[model samples]
Target chain A: MKRRTEVVLAGLGGQGLILIGKILGEAAAIYEGKNSVQTQSYGVASRGGFSKSEVVISSEEIAYPEVLDPDVVLTLSQQAYDLYKNKVRKDCWLIYDSDTITGEGVSDKEFGFPITTVAVELRNTRILNMIALGILVKLTGIVSVESILRSLEKNIPSQFRDVNLRAFQRGLEMS
Target chain B: MHDRIKFLQGNEACVEGALTAGASFYAGYPITPSSEIAELASIRLPAVGGVFIQMEDEIASMAALVGASMAGAKAFTATSGPGFSLMQENIGLAIMTEAPCVIINVQRSGPSTGLATKPAQADVMQARWGTHGDHAIIVLSPASVQECYELMIQAFNFAEEFRTPVIFLSDEIVGHMREKVILRDDIPIVNRKFPKVDPPEYRPYQPGEDGVPPLAYFGSDYIFHASSSMHDETGYPNNVPDNAEKVIKRLYKKIYDHRDEIIITKEYETEDAEIILVSFGASARSAREAVYILRESGYKAGLLQLNTLWPFPDEKVRQLADRAKFMVVPEMNLGQIISEVKRVVEARIPVYGVNKVNGEIITPYEILGKIKEVF
Candidate 1:
């Protein structure tokens, strides 16, 4: 059987779900030379609108552009968890923010990570997305840390490249 | 070709293909099904020393593209049904002024906002006649992600070569579907031919025997006033009936005189088949697959995939219509292109339509059912 993993990153707008999706998709498709597809959906309301970026990476050919079900579901908001908690397979891993997600007994397989707390503790609240990215990198090992850093260096602006690298490293360091 | 084949959505392939085709300017508004084109363009264009502008609306997006193309940049914009409707006035302007630019209509279900993120091929006729009144257009519909990349380059080539706006008529299926796309880095790219004539004797509307007017760059000290009104060969205002008639006639003549060069269609098993399936864009993809299934089941089914949609490939369609006893038209819309097929076929054969507007693809099975029904 082909090792295929479908990941769904759900959050409110401005949480950099799209960026994380792009980075991971590019890392798999461009670096690992695997087949990957990333798609995103957002609402009309900015900032607070429910946004989600779904990605599927596989060693074999992938079809059905949208992820019908995901192997891993990561959420940053209660709305996201509520929207997607039921859809994820029972055996799949669930990652949620303990800082924001309040719904309990949803999934005993869930791992609560205080991503916002980690970002604030790192003295840069803007790195919440990077911290999440770091967690994603460590959890899956779908892509090498070097490849993620290289993609980040190429993707982020020159002014804040070092800070984002630090944030990525910090996320990699956490658990 | 680099030996790397990657799976990509049709929208992303279009972006990469545009970059490969030397497109340096893209202006578009955010709309679903077509938003990926804009997003990819925004991220990729800047890296290639190109410019991407998110205009306030489709109108400005169309205008800015025209302006950018006039400045000698290979420009393009992507829109869907409503946005395509808003772009009609400017499309007509491009028709009149003969500006070379590409417009990608990643069509979705609509008369007006019917389904914002759904798929439809309802814009086929609109692409040809949407701009209004006696104009020539070259529209290419891509059936796969590979074609999305290949046809975009062709769209630009046709636009620049003929000095008219070329429309890449895509739909939400090919616009959003993910498939393997092999991008070529060394595809033959063409740029607009700038006039080498002296500025003093230049006529913006001057046409050779071939009906193509030489393109003059704006702000080049050439003071020709390009207008949507009737003009003389010297690009000056003219109200004379003959002058207007001559200008309009030449505009049509440029495309009509070269329809043999402009028209493109793929003939699959049409040489000796009683039943012919005529479709374009996404429907053609399903039709091709359906035809293969029919062939496997011991039925003689052929497919005519229309790559060039405008000037409407009447000859090829008529030829197929004359020989085939049954014709099936599969589209994402109800009876759009089938009407044209019916017109040219002149009821010589039984015409059937496999139509869908429910925001889902009319599957190969549906088309196969229609083929069986007609057979």
Candidate 2:
């Protein structure tokens, strides 16, 4: 049987969910030599509308690109949590930002991290997705931290790379 | 672990393929789901000393493409459904004038702007007959990012080789999705055949033995006239009935004579298939998954994925129909390609359609349900 991991990163449109999703897929595909596909959907509104990116990493060829049942989900907004809370399997790992979302009755395998609060402390709220990414990597081990760092170097602009790396390190420590 | 492996969206992959195929000019108006091609072209083309222009509308963009191609530049443009509709006139002009160019339509759902950012294969028929008249066109569809890169080169090659406009029909799902693509450096590139005759002896519309006229750029030493109106071997407007018939016949013959080379399809697990699912573009991905699920559960299912949409692989589908007991076509529109499949099958086997226009993909389970309901 081929090993596969389906991940959904959900948040508001401006929270960079798609960026983190690309980084995860790039790490799996470019660095690890695994097959990966990333797809995203967002509403019409630029900033506040629902946004989600789905990444499927597999040892075999991926025929269906969409995530039918996600093994891991990260939600940075309350609306995103509500949307995917019931869609995922019960044993799936659900990670949410405790700073903005309440995970009262979501899943037994749930971990709530203060993702945005840590980003605030790191002096840049925009790197919240990278911090959330670090926590997800630490908890699930879906991708190596070194691979993710290499992907970040290729994907992130040069001026903001230091701050984003700092935020990812902070989240790794928190996890 | 090669350095050439990179993650790329389907739209970006198309631009990379275009650049690799010696595309030196791009003129397009940005639209949702396809704007990435233009955005990336704007940045990439300048570095390579190519021209990138944001035309006033899709109409002007296509006109600019024809103009640029006539000047000996491999040119392309990207747009969606509404923009595609706007470009039909110039596309028809490109066909009539035998100007080589490429048009990438990252299709969205619509009669007219129904869903701007959603995926749809509804443009299948439009791509075939959208520009009108009794002319033949080449259209290629890609289901993955890698295919987007690979087929875009083929699209350019077909356009240049046939000296006609080729349409790269993509949908929102394939356009927006990102996947690993190996940027192979050893791709075979094809360019238009230039006339070997002197400037005075060049007859623009005169066909060689293969029924395709050798093209000469406008500003070269060659001086020739190209008009959308009916013309004879000299390429000026003749408007005689005999000239019209000869000109139109050559247009069709140039493509249909080389049909076997232009048409491409992929078949999976069809050696002993009882039921075959025929699909194209993004929905074909779902159909392939359905085939896998069905075969795993003791069903003899197979898939025939059409990578070339326009000269509709009637011969291949008909061959599959001879072997399979049943055929199903799953598309994002209300039975566009299914009609062609049914026509080719000739009611020998039961043909079914799984159609969806609700801005969501036709899932594999949905196809399985349709199969079980009929099985």
Candidate 3:
């Protein structure tokens, strides 16, 4: 029923959030036969600064690429949540990582899970965003799990592909 | 895997378009927002048996591109605000020497190095006038990632066909934005029209009936001269008034006389519309969305998106103004193209500018708000 939805993923640098945004957008655009635009903005530092990526998906052409007001948001850090929490629709589905970010004064219309904790338990903490991505897929069903799997295979290197795939599957199961 | 659809960034698509257009040389310096073009070119150019050189700076990069083009290669370079300003002099050189090449400006905000990572559509006028002197330039403004690929092919085609420097002016939002692009090999590709005259009979700068000089490459069988000063048919710098006058007239006429063929503008929902929104590049994206919003609300609003930035799309805009009540120009800068629109409309109709310049894109709501006020 959703014709258009904007999703924002915010985190500190080196959180692999940009990679997650790319995979989600590619899956929707390339496999789901939908229009998608991925726009990211980050601080000047290569790492250790605030960074975020926003993807807007629509059944028709996406006119404006940036997230005007998010339908869904996944904030992995306190600073990021504080900055973007006010920039979403009142009816937005807020998803946060409880292990990495505190839920103090967070919204009532929200969900929380330890996405990073799940990834760490799986023995590769870098796949935290993949877990977040999986939960997002379960919530919105923006793109198929098969599309995400294909994107993961194309984007991830052979050396670490198995772990990333496992992380995606585990995140899906958790959701 | 045959009909591969790609979620390609606009910058990456621009590079691919150049490669597909037979661009064999790339000389560039890395800058934010536009650096991906250079990075991808460096990686892909070599695999395709082309040359990719990271020049010392923008000046050298542009100079190298000019050198490569004169040596008979489809050459290009990409830059942002600061680098675009730096390459202006060499662009003028290329213009004067009639070297066919493409220079891409992935626009960001700035009089200097302003918001290198952010998007701005301020370079609309700079692409046409950045180079010194009165010269005719072809500038193409692409709105989407697919146009980023398709228009680059057009850019290369116009460069070779007209024997002039073509500017591919794309903004930061479109440059960094990623969208699904079809990478099919069915698009038409054009190479430069080479002269068939004998070595002793060839005149490198001589204009045919179309006023475009058939390019003769360096180290070719024919001896040729290329210079920045006003040159005659012999390609030697000429300061005489008659020779200079003829050459200048030919240069302007080559593009201006063919303006009808060179200028390109796309009209959206113009039928039975009262007010029209005129915009180009990334700002046009929002203008289009605003028009959609207005029409859905039963308002008679339309959009005129300029895909060809240079030559100002004068006659076409005038034709659109004939049917519309007024015009609204929204851009990232204060108001560059609005003045041109007014000039073409001759102020018989109202042409207003909705300006924004905070290193951000103009949103649909902003443009729709302005449109509501006008209504």
Candidate 4:
């Protein structure tokens, strides 16, 4: 019943962070029947560089796309974590990769986990964003777990749907 | 309208809107922030039995759209500032020949490639007069992603209805932004009014009562010449002083006469406000927020969102300016549309500008800061 929820997915360019952002947006719009906007920022390098995708979900039309002091910030790289942790609201949910980040400046609102480690242990490193997405949905309740899986199934290639779904479930159990 | 909703980026919404408007041909070169339009068009056009081409450059892309229009295909192309500069000459050709087409400029920062990946509304003036001619133009700006979708459909309609090139002016913020939109099945689509008479009787440049001349297809039995030269009623090249005047006047008259219907602006909380904030595209979104924040702090503020920029919505702005004591113009660029706002309000009241040119957006806080300083 929240009117607006701001979520940011920040990571390196190749980490599939944009994908996770899109899935979250689709889950909100397509499955949960909410209004969503997904905007992205990336470096000129186009690969393995800093990138961020900001998504805003609302019950009504959203005028502005850029999220200011996002409610939930998910970071996959240390640089992303360091850059955004200082910027978000004090009570903001700062989720980061425990394997890659030390949770230095943000220990109070931090929900650090070994995101990459879990994906690697699951034998698929590409599902790193999916794990974060799973945890994000659970902690914020922006959208249901079923909405995330449904969006993933609609977007991901048929060959990789099952593995991505399993990774999302692994993420859900984290919280 | 489909009850189901979907999250769509501004670029993706543009493609869907064009398709809904019956755009059958797309010719554009890929540019950052605007490439998603071409990418989606390439796939969507083919699926709908249309054609999509990656032209060698922006020039050819615009030229191709003009050529496709002659053959009676609703066509459009997208580009950024640098590419928009390339398409200027051809945009003039569309204006001179009275070709019906649409051009989407997903504006980015710079006079020359200042920031390819960033968002800026600096191209507002360029879109109005970049083609280097005294001709009429209709440029519509969209503030949100849904407007990106909705305005594009109107852009196509305006192009066809007036037999002129319509510019869908979107900044990078609106072009790259994503939003939930209901893909309505009931969009009002307009096609170019075709000639009903035989080939021998048709005069391509002759305007009806509305000043819009009927368009004839290339392969159709009703044959008519299409050229970039100043032509008379018959669409033949005529350099006579009187005939040239008629050609130019008619071209301007069509849109000018219909300016009331063509220009659109949204006024918010302005009934009793002492200050009016004027903005368009992403800047308007920020300005709207500033209005509410100002109200909460006991200062009465209103917002005038210019959805139609080319004709400049002067009458509506004048009325609003008369009621308000001051006007604040905020944009991502230094001061383009602010000049127009000043011209409209004249010296009657103070007009202030909040400008930023660092390839970053003008935030609500900045607009509020400017208002605070002036008051």
DockQ of 3: 0.77
User: Could you tally the backbone clashes for each prediction?
Assistant: 0, 0, 0, 2
My TM-score estimates for the predictions, one after another, are: 0.73, 0.98, 0.96, 0.96
Which model is ahead, 1 or 3, in terms of DockQ? 3
- State the fnat of model 3: 0.71
> Which stretches in model 1 have alpha-carbon errors above 4 Å?
A1-175, B1-4
Among all windows of 10 consecutive residues in model 4 chain B, the one with the lowest summed lDDT is B1-10
lDDT (10s digit) by residue, model 3, range A97-157? 9887776545555778888778779988778888888888887677899998988888789
Predictions' DockQ, in order:
0.11, 0.84, 0.77, 0.62
Candidate 4 lDDT, A39-155, residue by residue in tens = 888877778988999898888866556786588999999899888867877778899999998786553577888898899889999899888888888987878888887888888
- Which CAPRI quality tier does the interface of model 4 achieve? medium
Q: Candidate 1 lDDT, tens digit per residue, B142-218?
A: 98777898889888888888889999989877786555567877678887666678888888778766777778777
> Which segments of model 2 are wrong by more than 4 Å?
A1-3, B1-3
Residue-level lDDT of model 2, residues B1-375, one tens digit each, is: 222777999999999999989899999999998999999999999999999999999999999999999999999999999999999999999999999999999999887878887888998888999997999999999999999999999999999999999999999999999999977767789999999998899999899898889999989999989898888899889988888898899999999999899999999999999999999889999999999899889999999999998898989998999999999999999999999999999999999999999999999999999999999
Candidate 4, DockQ score (0 to 1): 0.62
**Which of the numbered candidates is closest to the native, going by highest TM-score?**
2
Worst-scoring 10-residue span by lDDT in model 1 chain B: B1-10
Q: If candidate 4 were superposed on the true structure by all CA atoms, what would the RMSD be?
A: 1.8
lDDT of 3 by residue, B64-134 (tens): 98899999999999999999999999999988888889999999888887776788888877888888788
What overall lDDT goes with each candidate model? 0.82, 0.92, 0.87, 0.88
